[model samples]
Target: MVELTVREALRDAMAEEMRADGDVFLMGEEVAEYQGAYKVSQGLLEEFSPRRVIDTPITEAGFAGIGVGAAMAGLRPIVEFMTFNFAMQAIDQIVNSAAKTSYMSGGLVNVPIVFRGPNGAASRVAAQHSQCYASW
Candidate 1:
């Protein structure tokens, strides 16, 4: 039997998808230069180049929108939110742009995207950091 940490499994999935499809790419704060805020993106930049693994500012809504737009353009985008709680800032985009782009566009646009979040704050934290990733 083989066992893998959540981070490992997520990384493997993203890596495989990127390798299989040139249209698949990952982008988020600290994903490239910082190797992901949680280290889930540790070796992606080195393995796939900066073009496929991108780094952005700490603007969740902005990046989420960009990811959704890219997905609408026929590209698969993986977006990481430092914490799921903060994802609220971009929830509108996820629900409207990423999830319903095709329906809203009368099936002309399909948003193929993966959204990952709630990282580095699962214990004794407060406020938005108090999110539960029970089965993440």
Candidate 2:
């Protein structure tokens, strides 16, 4: 058995999927040059190049919407939000667009994408950044 950290596990998953299928790619902020906020995509840009591993701007809503569009168009895009707190800006894209597209389209479209990142509070992050709204 290979032991891996959460970041390493996520990186491996992305790499393996991208290698197995050319349609799979990753997109999000800090996912390329910075190697991801938590380094979950470390070394991926080096292997897959910028075309498959896109480091988008800080516009979460824009990038998230783009990812949903890419998914609906038959490409498998993995979207990272840095943290769930920031993802709130793209909730409409996720819930109304990505989540409802397949059902609304009667399976005509498939959103085989994954939106992942750290959720909930971390130590010393304080109220603004540490708030946990899992129940909300």
Candidate 3:
């Protein structure tokens, strides 16, 4: 068996998927030039270019809504938040729009998107960043 950190595993999986499908792209804050907030997306920008590996502003809802829209248009989007706590800012886009659109459209619209990020507590982080929102 091969051992890999969570970051490496995620990067490898995304890279594999992107290599297999042209529509698979990754988007999030600092995922490109910054190599991800936790370095999980290291080297993806160089391999996929800015077109596939995109960096967005701090507005989570904005980018997430874009991801959902792209998914509805037949693109597979991977959205990475800096932390799951911040994902609350985009909850409407994730839960209401992306999660509900397929049923709302009677299976005519399919949202193929993935939202990924670190979650729960960590050492020396701010209080707001330390709370676990995964179970909520």
All candidates: TM-score: 0.90, 0.92, 0.97
Query: lDDT for model 3, on a 0 to 1 scale?
Result: 0.95
Clash count of each predicted structure: 1, 0, 0
In candidate 3 the C-alpha lDDT for residue 15 amounts to 99
Per-residue lDDT tens digits for candidate 3, residues 67-93, read 999999999999999998899999999
Per-residue CA lDDT of model 2 for 13-70, tens digit only, reads 8899999999999999899999998788999999999999998888888999999999
What's model 3's lDDT at 3? 100
Best by TM-score: 3
Find the candidate with the highest lDDT and give its number. 3
**Rank ordering of all candidates by lDDT, starting from the highest:** 3, 2, 1
What does the lDDT read for residue 4 in candidate 3?
A: 100
lDDT: the better of candidates 1 and 2: 2
Write model 1 residue lDDT over 1-136, tens digit each, in one string: 9899988888998899989999999999789988876789989999999899999888989999999889878898999887777787898998877888788789887888999875445666787676564665
Q: What lDDT does candidate 3 reach at residue 47? A: 97
| TM-score of predicted structure 3 | 0.97
